[model samples]
Target: MTATVAIDSYFTPVPDEIEAIDLVVEGALPPELNGRYLRNGPNPKPGAPPAHPFVEPGMVHGVRLKDGAALWYRNRWVRTSLFTESATRVRPDGSLDLAACHANTHVIEHAGRTFALVESGLPYELSLDLDTVGPCDFQGRLTTAMTAHPKADPVTGDLHFFGYGVRPPFLTYHRLSASGELVQSVPVEVPGPTMMHDFAITEDYLVWMDLPVVFERTELGVPYRWSDSYGARLGLMPRKGGPVRWFEIEPCYVFHVGNARQDAAGRVVLDAVRYDRATFRNEWDLAAGKEKTGSVPGQMLHRWTLDPRTGVRSEQQLDDWSLEFPTLNENLVGLQNRFLYLVGGGSVVKFDTVNGERGVHRLPDGAKPGEAVFVPAENARAEDDGWLLTIVSNRIAGTADLLVLDATDVAARPVATVHLPRWVPSGFHGSWVPESVVR
Candidate 1:
């Protein structure tokens, strides 16, 4: 008999959606934080769970802040064709239904539009109030699935993203202009289909990871198993148009990237969390509610510097401590960013990449923190001058909080704590939608 996937742990799905106004604030909220802290995660319906925790229907939790006050908090399902109408991505005739997706991974904004995203299909737009509008295909131009981890160029205002699948032309790169027009969609050449979740970008180049996690027929769909023979490599493609320059690197799996930038020497440097063979399989099994295996280390901070002139490069393990959900200041996405913020088991860490210093904020017992999103301060003076916005959930209390901490000093007390009405399940990725950027 097959073991059942557990949903009663920290990731238990909330049964219903509710709203609360005039939320109580524990600490002083900065008047400048006039926006919504929106997060999306998998929240499978009560009787309807997916094969894994990551593929369930998506539910978005949002907290609205205005003028130093917590105005309201609301939770809404993304209401995709899958969530509401029980739609499937493939039709009876084998046609693909990209709109029938679970937009349950991340929520981001571009070209004045907010969207809920999952890597398997098109994005579903959401209103400021957290209501799903619909799927966006850039005027029928996007023929493939969109990865949840799209990078928006800080200087160019252009969006860089890619999509991968089980079919040939396994990887495709797409770009959207500053005004939201789908400008370019190029077929990136990869050997076969892999779980290409995330990528990075610098001022002049795009970063791609072609790891060993391949797709095949299995009891659990889209199994993330490691393959020694497939090998691992990172690719660098010119934004102007050129074939991807592949660099053979260490074998590992990366679910997220902290940031990537170009050094003064014109080489591309990238920071991200890495998982080895054992660790990736172990973690993947635990997430799928399968039986856990041998003890292995969790994800670690790793870096890679690649040069175009010569295919030579250096790889380094930045840290041994386990961490995930790496984030940095959006303005420095593909530029010089010295500070990186991440979430650990029960604490948040701020890593100074240049000096190898780490500042941590340990939460109270039984508190699980989600991704830490960096929002630049109104009077920002330094690279770390911002507020780290994250959702902390306490399962014992059946509640959660929108915790805001100063980015420069993670050890310092929270800048504000907006009390949420109910407990929020551990979700994937989200965005802090500042109201000023919307209208």
Candidate 2:
């Protein structure tokens, strides 16, 4: 038998939560940026054995900014059933507890309410001060797990997302109103169960990636694995409800979508990072603390254009940089977006679709940065007229800092830097909730 190696210390979690006020700041923080930057990720409790990266409990780190000052920095666990009770979702009657979630994937605010979300369970409500308010099922209307990558339509204010399980009704599409009411739930038909991490959106449709990664039952627990026979496809579901139109695309996996849009000609274009079979397996094994079999290729930006009228699909490689955690201005969620941001090779990369230029902001030595979240400037005119917010952690010094850079020129010096009081483990996704939105 082969022994598994230990998880990488690249992102070590701090044992306890802490808070600090009036943190030291470098450079000028935009006074207009009066909000909180909250991030969530996997963090096992102290003395807990290392488990699969995704199985760890969820923790959120937040930094508040107001009137050009870094007001406070706080980190808190979601206090889910997993955290507080060490409970299992499986009941004695074999029913599943949808609320027994780690709530570790992302944090966002909608309709004056904030939620900590995971892909496999109900979203956990959170207070403005980062306290857990308990599990929320939209007043008993939500019967399915919610996707952490929900997209709020800037024009209509509808939140679009989906959930997948191993049983019947594998994939279900859902939508929430601007006031945070559950309005629509439709079962989406897929040939088989696959790991659908994220999806995309356009003006008139929602883009779905049915890739090669399929679910498999393992001895320990059921997990998704790459399958050559499962095939690959991209489907288009109308917002008003109708039959889905799926297009055949090359077999690949996309964990994140940068942005997507549809033209008047019924042509849809999606930009995201693609990983082949070997690359994904390498990543999967690494997260499991297993030895790599061979060289692991990097993830690159790929563009897919599907034309429904002619039943044709064209694809291209957009960039060679290894990337992840793609993000853009939320206001342009389903619209034509010119600027997209991602992090790779210890830098924040900004891509301009019109000019075909890549702007990069490389971090200092030994400092690793998380996703570069785009926050649009007040009364912003240009697509890149915003700030790029990220948490930069130094593995060597056991420290973390909040970095704010000008979106127009990512390679430029940061607009502000807030020195955090504790070492924040690298996290998944978060939101920049303006004070007005949550108030």
CA RMSD of all predictions: 3.6, 3.9
Error of 2 at 64 (Å): 0.6
* TM-score for each of the candidates: 0.96, 0.96
Over 4 Å off, model 1: 1-8
Lowest lDDT 10-mer window, candidate 2?
1-10
- Model 2, 1-439: lDDT tens per residue? 1112232365577778888899999999999999999999988899987677676789999999999999999899999987898778878899889888789899999898999999888999999889999998888988888888999999999888888877768899999999999988899999988889899889888999999989896432437789989899999888778888999888999988988898778799998889988888887777666788877788888899988678788999888777889899988987889888999768888987767689999997667899888999999999889999999877766678899999998999999999898677788888898999885
Model 1, position 206, has a per-residue lDDT of 95
lDDT per model vs. reference: 0.89, 0.87
lDDT of 1 by residue, 213-323 (tens): 888656556545678889999999999999889999989999999999999999999899999999898988888888877678889999999998898888999988899
- Candidate 1, after superposition: displacement of residue 224 in Å? 3.8
TM-score of 2: 0.96
